[model samples]
Target: MKIAVLVYGSPTASSAAATAYRYARAAIGLGHQITRVFFYGEGVHGASALAAPPQDEVNWGQRWQQLAQEHEIEMIVCIAAALRRGVLNQQEAQRHGKSAANLAAGFELSGLGQLADAALNSDRLITFGG
Candidate 1:
């Protein structure tokens, strides 16, 4: 199966983001193809490079990055939502004249078109968030 995941929860708010991460791992473990992981709304926080959780706290960003690295999953963050929430990649930061970018590795900034493509091409489009 080809599965695409949409996340809308912040990593620290609730279990939605963590659940989505587990779902992606489980799907991959079951030999399913991950078409994409689109982070929207608060979920875009999971891709913020500036995030620094406590040592005991789970750094969801690193987890997602490792997952993508090992599984080759396409991780994307909605550009609008990310910018509104203060997450920016190098290119976007330069374009917006920001001092620095805070987008984490293993993720890319894009519009809803990527999500639309995932929905149109994947066998399943799973969403995790309110």
Candidate 2:
């Protein structure tokens, strides 16, 4: 099966991203394909390179990055949500007069079309959100 998980809450405040991560890892481990992981709302924060967690806490941002790298997951952040929250890509930062871009590696900034596409392509579109 091809699964698309949509995460729409904060990394620390909400466990949506963490739940999505576990679902993705488990699905892949069970011989399923993760078509895409869509980050929306505060879920975009998981892609921020500047996110710092306490030493004892799980660094979800880095964990997502590593999961993408290790499993070749297609991780995408909602551009509208990201832009509203000040998460920008290098090109977007330059165009919008921002000082920094922290969308980070392994995650792409994309529009709703990507989410729609993932929905169409996926065998199941599961959502994790508040």
Candidate 2 lDDT over 3-31, as tens digits, reads 88899888878888888888888998999
Candidate 1: tens digits of C-alpha lDDT, residues 1-130: 9999999988888787899999999999999998799999999999998889889988889999999998889999999999998899889899999999999988999999999999999999999985
Candidate 2: deviation at residue 125, Å?
0.7
What Cα-based lDDT does every candidate model obtain?
A: 0.92, 0.88
Every candidate's CA RMSD: 0.9, 1.0
Best model per lDDT: 1
Candidate 2 clash pair list: none
lDDT of 2 at 76: 91
